[model samples]
Target chain A: MKSEARKPFSKDIIHIENIDQVCNDIIAKLKMDVTKNLQRRGAIVGISGGIDSSVCLALSAKAFGSKNVLGIMLPEQDSSDDSRHLAEKLAATYGVSTLIEDITKALDGFGCYERRDEAILRVIPDFDKKVDKAKIEIKQNIAENIPAIFSITVIKPNGDVVSKLLPAREYLQIVASTNFKQRSRMSMLYYHAERMHYAVIGTPNKHEVEQGFFVKYGDGGADVMPIGHFYKTQVYQLAKHLGVPQEIIDRTPTTDTYTAEQSQEDFFYQMPFESMDLIWYGWENNYPAEEVGKVMGKTTKEIENIYKSFERKRKTTEYLRMKPIF
Target chain B: MKSKNDVKTEIKKYILEASLSDVKDVEDDALIFENGLLDSMGLLFLIEFLGETFEVEVNDDELNPKNFESINNIVSFVNNKLSVKV
Candidate 1:
């Protein structure tokens, strides 16, 4: 590990200038594409009150008209109450038509919670079903040279929490089970879209889409992706320009599908969004590890390890980004 | 409008393009989902493709595995829906 002191970097890492112009350009492109290519009059976005969805919704409203852009609030048992409230608040603020779809029944129909619990039990032997809560996280240990490891944390009723390393089978089960929520919401979106002759819009940002951080066919399923090109940092810029709610703007990103309040940082990317944006941008641009390390106040070895971790994730989740194999 | 055979060919092309598994010569009667040739996400793409290609509404209820189990099933489903539209 190196000291935290480092020299100034050359330029902005993931910052975008002329935020309004860029935002309007994105909106114009989405509008033109939807009207001409898709031949759809309107767009539908699932609003989680997260920055990504909020930006996408605002763009869609600007592109297709507030009356044409439908904002869907998909909430399940594990979803935070704030998710619905904040999403509704955004829809109202934007004058966009909104609907709520309670996905608890749909997730239950697929036995999502039960399957997830079964997987958790494999890692936490004495994990209580009633009062114990659990969440899974992926971590990279550069010192140990381990690219990725799945870990489970079980919080008992008495406030005792224990963490255990997960085997591949248990990890797979847990992820597959948690993914049911996204798929249920996607199904509901398509149901409404088909009836209304509207197109479904996906809200994945640059990091999630490029780094393979999404569940295939679940949250990844959409007729069009309006914000796939913007980095997480750029998304916040767009959100500010779009007048997204301040509470939504300041909220930390969370998986929100798990029973526990797990952050996207702990669950997937080992670094926070700000650092990740710079690291990923540097890596993608083929900047040397030493240079990136100097810029980010880390050692060259640390930067190299982060690049390795990113590639490992990309390779393992390549299937999510693939076209049907021939 | 294209014939059902043309529709089958189009659907076959989509399955071949969207599936990641090595299914170069998938049988029309083969169970695509059971054989792991297609998945939930693939099904969603197929639904979108069908909706766009046939101009038929594919609702959530029609996303059953039976409707997408094989090329034959997809062809029949599209034809049935198109017939109703006509």
Candidate 2:
């Protein structure tokens, strides 16, 4: 396909050539957003020694400054040594403050017991029953079965006393706990930003933002998304351009929820990043999942599923993409 | 007989369902957040689910971390909130 096959989302031109202009415009808008909304500048980032976060941190450091940036590192107990090392290394290199908190403690404290590690068919919930569907994952033995993985935590109420978790199931209980961690971090980040006077920097990319991949009010939640529009491929490229370590470039990305062996794709039925990325880029670019999947030689069902999910998320994340509600 | 027990059992069923960690033997004092247990928001969602499900209202102050640290705490907190609301 030709480069021109897909047109830009808008004529606003948030391109690399004018990155500085775009960033400045974004900051001005954020400042204005805060002023108009009567909010403060606070940014929280889950810097998982990964390319996306590395790039996001670097850019955020420039946009806001090192002091305004809060780098949260949540590693599953068994997470690869490299990710933690790279995370701390990246933080030290970029001058962003860091927090090394583990989710395992939360797992044990909450009375969790994992039996089955995987599932063939998972329960699907309908909104009618008011059934929180994601909670079903916590029912099985998967909690201990899966190693803790990577994820951003934000807890509310008492941000200082937030809970961490094993990133396993027991959905409502621990997800709320873990989510509280994410939300807590965010809450604290926002509070600190309000106190310190800075905007919150979200690390979502075009792919994740478009896919509705992030849990609502979780990692997907951010006051100012610095790199939401960048594709994952673009992020890696940008990270490399910015001289990010090579190991982070090749390391597998995980939410740091389960054991270190888990990855971001574990819940997605083993979808590969390359495949998911291409399909995601295609859909985001509006190539039509069928057409893009056909080009990629994906199965008809896969294409159909991709289209349905893409459409659903496009609608869901649309609100996020727009200027804040204020 | 079934009124309280049924309510209690059903509540347990739902807690197990809503929780992210497996809910086999959670006690009253289990520290949900510190042990990497139920996140605070997850607890809130569970609380919201309980309130909505049982047609109860939990005051903001009652949603403190202490009440939701374990299954027993959750049950007691819910029962108390529900009874008070009733």
Count of backbone clashes for each model? 5, 68
Residue B31, model 2: lDDT of 56
Which consecutive 10 residues in model 1 chain A have the weakest lDDT in total? A139-148
List, in the given order, the native-contact fraction of each candidate. 0.00, 0.00
Clashing pairs in 1: A324-B18, A324-B19, A324-B20, A325-B19, A325-B20
lDDT of 2 by residue, A1-326 (tens): 55576553331222256545655665565446544664655455677787777877776666557776778776544346677789888888778898766755554444332211112012121111121112121111111211112221222233332222222233334445444445544555565556667666677777677755565666666776766777666567567666677778888776554332345665432356656666665655566545665666766556655554445445535664565566
lDDT of 1: 0.80
Residue-level lDDT tens digits of model 2 in B1-86: 12555566776666556564465655446655444444433554565566557765544334444566566666676677666665
Question: Each candidate's chain B TM-score?
Answer: 0.87, 0.66
The positional error of residue A198 in candidate 1, measured at the CA in angstroms, is 0.7
Give interface RMSD, every candidate, in order: 15.8, 13.4
Residue A200's lDDT in candidate 1? 91
Q: Which candidate leads in lDDT?
A: 1
Report the number of backbone clashes for model 2: 68
